[model samples]
Target: MAGLPVALAAAGALAYGTAFGLFGEDARTTAGAAAPAWAEEAADGFASVDALGQKGTYGGRGGPVVTVRTLADLEKYATAPGPHVIVVAGAIPVNPVGKEIKVASDKTIIGSGTSGHIVGGGFFLGPGVHNVIIRNLTIRDTYQGVWNDKDHDFDAVQMDGAHHVWIDHNDLRHMADGLIDSRKDTSYVTVSWNRLGNNNKTFGIGWTENTTADLTIHHNWFRETEQRNPSTDNAAHAHLYNNYLQDDPGTAVTSAYGNYARGRTAMVLENSYFQGLTNPVIKDATASLVQRGNVFSGTRGRNESGGTGFDPRRFYPYTLDAAADVPAIVTAGAGPRSALGTPRAAATRTLTVAKDGSGQFTSVQKAVDAVPAGNSSRVVIQVKPGTYREAVKVPSNKPHVTLQGMGASRKDTVLVEGRASGTPRPDGSGTYGTGGSATLAVEADDFQARNLTVANDFDEARNQHLTGHQAVALRTAADRVLLDALIISGDQDTLLLDTAAKDRPGRVRLTNSYVIGNVDFVFGRATAVIDRSVLTLKKRWDGTSAGYVTAPSTPAGRKGFLITRSTVNGDVTAGSFFLGRPWHAGGDATLDPQTTVRDSVLSAAVRPAPWTDMGGFSWKDDRFAEYRNTGPGAGPAGADRPHLTDAQAADQEIADWLGDWTPAAG
Candidate 1:
């Protein structure tokens, strides 16, 4: 909640006085015009609550929004660090067929329109992984040609010891195991608006004996699915509402039971319709179950109810549609919709770059070259996964240009160049110098790059004889720029945050990303906020342990670099790195540079005296400070080290650094 999400969330929290009102329209989970209405919506029901040391279900809400087509890309983003809104846009036939992709935390794997499909594979959420949303996709065909296959434990979506997840609007069927398996005491989950069919084990609630799982399942159509229409076992509170369960005649599959509560589970089933199903509702002797306003037609067997179950309204407010309108409503809106996850304007404003020549252009620069010089609208350059061995530059005139990597992980796509400050130009125009050594130079306003790795591999060890070693991975020379979910790696001066001199304005937001370097990696004069990202302190190429994370050269009172809710760690020598130092930039004493690292975790690699003097400019005179920093490297404030007061730190918030410019997903 560092950047635009905080403001968007407040506006969304009043939609309908219920859970629908909890999120704003701008708190979008999808991108493009083809995005479904619900795909843009946030989590509902139990998954929307903040409990069990986890935030509410905001799948990649504050991170980048990307579209994935291949299994490798899906797994990469699913397992990558930080939050990502992954839109599956094509039929990705699993390579190994039944392999279950282990998904990490803070992710949204959604389908693009009706075309997105996960064939013969599924997703798995392991222990401690939270804040996930899987919606509007077709996950099926892992049947192994066996109706009761016990060999393969394949499931469309499975979670073990995971919490705060929402599985909605999916069509899951024909899997080797349960389509949706919430096992090992997974808590705070909501299963809604999905269509589960053609499976033996449709859904299973528990594998653990502890009654700690909390769930809310609603607005789903369970058709021709056998048992465990989500059999709740050892669950603390299970609320099922407005669901349609039916088994018509001549169907190959038959319903065993609609909803079963067992092993000390407490369930409250309400406003559900069941047709031609046997044992629609059942409760074990050790479980507590209550059924209210349920419709069971042409169904025989145990329709039992007993003790009072836990109240769901005590958790989160929800409004349920009438039971009679469930089949009609779910029948039309259960699976993927037409508008969800599809490209609204793919024919325009998008350029494709691939090394394999599958895209419109073989090189990224060729695609950038295609844009008109004075282009005003935002144009996205979708670069496929490959090592682009070239430098890229976005001129200042080409504003609102986004270089997006078509990979699940940032490491999958690389824009690399081995250029250093001393690298000679082919035209014999002398050395490239510090400003020209950048691999990816963004000199345009409203520039953005995501799911990409921009690196300057200058080979310092092999090129030690070279005069200058300043290699910059990324450099921004414009304003309103966003580098989300990216990895910029180098040794010295890795990321230069700059402006068009002192008179011009520039602001960069680097969120949920990694900036790896040794000395002055994040040096610049621009007003930048590195929020919720990692600053990896790698050893210099010369094997030197000493380094500086930042070197800011801000003007008198304007904000410089503000690092918040980030981590500073690496496999470097302890007490060898300083947090930052003021940079007078050519010994200009008029510059009152400032850098503040607050609410972050610093490793022992950081020196106790984090701020040090440089070029006869004492850091004490500048604004090199830290506030409420933790970890082994953090130290007390002293004459050499500066710390911001609570009052002063409040003014340095991310909102303070970025005023009305809310950078969001394209």
Candidate 2:
């Protein structure tokens, strides 16, 4: 009874303390930390209106009007003391990075109109600056649309991070890197309501490293961009809601590192649309993200030798909308992902090839060589079902070339094969290395090879010296390359799904086809979907056969490889084929890249220890994933091989690696 009085007194003191703390309100937490020296004393000088219509530039303080005439005058007033607000009217600025407008702390730059542009370059932010708002402007022709390279970064405009920022209502285009990046810092930022485009290079958002957290990217339009780079894999725990992403014909949109073994990142993508071009979408991870309702239009290209790996959950949202120009589905919220509401002309304009000697030659490759590049009109060479012995090379200049073979993917096969290393060309003064000792070499972007079989028939022993003896089948190094019902065959580097170089990782789709090879043959860096294809390995007499089938040489910062809904078979002895080996030039297996296989069939010929170690290195560093594969080759859980859980398989973080784009099982 005596202790009750003490308890009541203590409770009363605690309540009084809590009330005082709540009423006092820490200024730093409520109004943000101290402003940088470069920032003016107050934020009330410029013209600004609050949500409730209260007007002030320096937070309603009666400050001087920070008058600026030209882009340079704005820069001068930005650094001064008396004027708080910085009214940037007239034309876009010139050299914003070098001048006075260096984005001081605690400031806002509200553009005059959607046409209020940033002409010279993007506004670069230094490290540690906080509390900034940049909105309602047209940003173009900068190194990056909005460049923020510092480590401790946050962003508002949907670009990369700079921390403590608000970026909304802008049209940003023609940049070298990502439109927005937030790979660094635990920045709570909101990037909403913007239009993002690529002037020439890769990515709409470049989320890198492991630091970014609590980011919301919503209601953004990513239209008419080119070549989404593989380095944009750093977006962890990101919310991508109601966005529209589309590219023109021949461009590639790929989401790299979704299945990264370092650990699956969390990405939430809902109510979005992706459409058009060669590779509408590509993913390379087994990430942990949520992609509830996304529509990916257009058929993903077939990999060299045929088939694609577009996952069912991620890629299934893409319905066959015959009315849509790009064969993709339209989602809620955003405008359609593409300018044209439907698929390419190939959807409607079917190619039928018959010759009463009307064309130059009966073969498809010959017709491609006859046509010139930059031809606005398309040339559809309808191919009849016969074994044509020749190599095909479609260069970058030769655009809009479509080769339609006679038959459905499974039934029809127009075969093309070559034998010698230096085969004589039609002009025939010398020989060209079209197939590099094998068959067809397709190097054309925006090129479609439908219902065809491209093969290589080089007898290994015939080429006495193994020095210049690398064989090839169909080497596709083009962006937006589609291989529908295509069959490719050879030994050793057979279907070289290779890029032109390391810099250019193309997007390819291999659907409803077959590829048969031995050794480290099926390999390269192309973001390919080997969906519903049969990969067979013929018997090899040579004891020198490595027996490794697919060697993915995906670079450190690139989307590695994906083999989904396909079959792997071999005629050789069981446990003869090593599923894959790391493709490092120095034979170092430690720098392992990411590779995944899901819902496919395998043969007993595949080794139980699926991954092969090279040059005294462990395979643990390598990134590899397999889900629900059935066959004798897919053995029980062991050291070298691990099974993917149903939850891991369903994670949208990894689904983004497949663009979470799935096509219907026809």
The lDDT leader among the candidates is 1
User: Over the full model, what C-alpha lDDT does candidate 2 score relative to the true structure?
Assistant: 0.51
Q: Model 2: residues >4 Å from true position, as ranges?
A: 1-360, 376-378, 408-413, 420-435, 464-468, 542-546, 586-592, 615-618, 645-666
Model 1 segments more than 4 A misplaced: 1-348
Query: What lDDT does each candidate get?
Result: 0.82, 0.51
lDDT of 1 by residue, 337-412 (tens): 5455543432339999999989999998888888888886779999999899899899988887889998766667
RMSD of each: 19.9, 23.5
Error of 2 at 662 (Å): 9.8
TM values, all candidates: 0.52, 0.46
Tell me the tens digit of each residue's lDDT in model 2 across 366-429: 6777667776545676776555666667777876677766644422444546454455546776
Worst 10 residues of 1 by lDDT: 15-24
Residue 174, model 2: Cα distance from true site in angstroms? 36
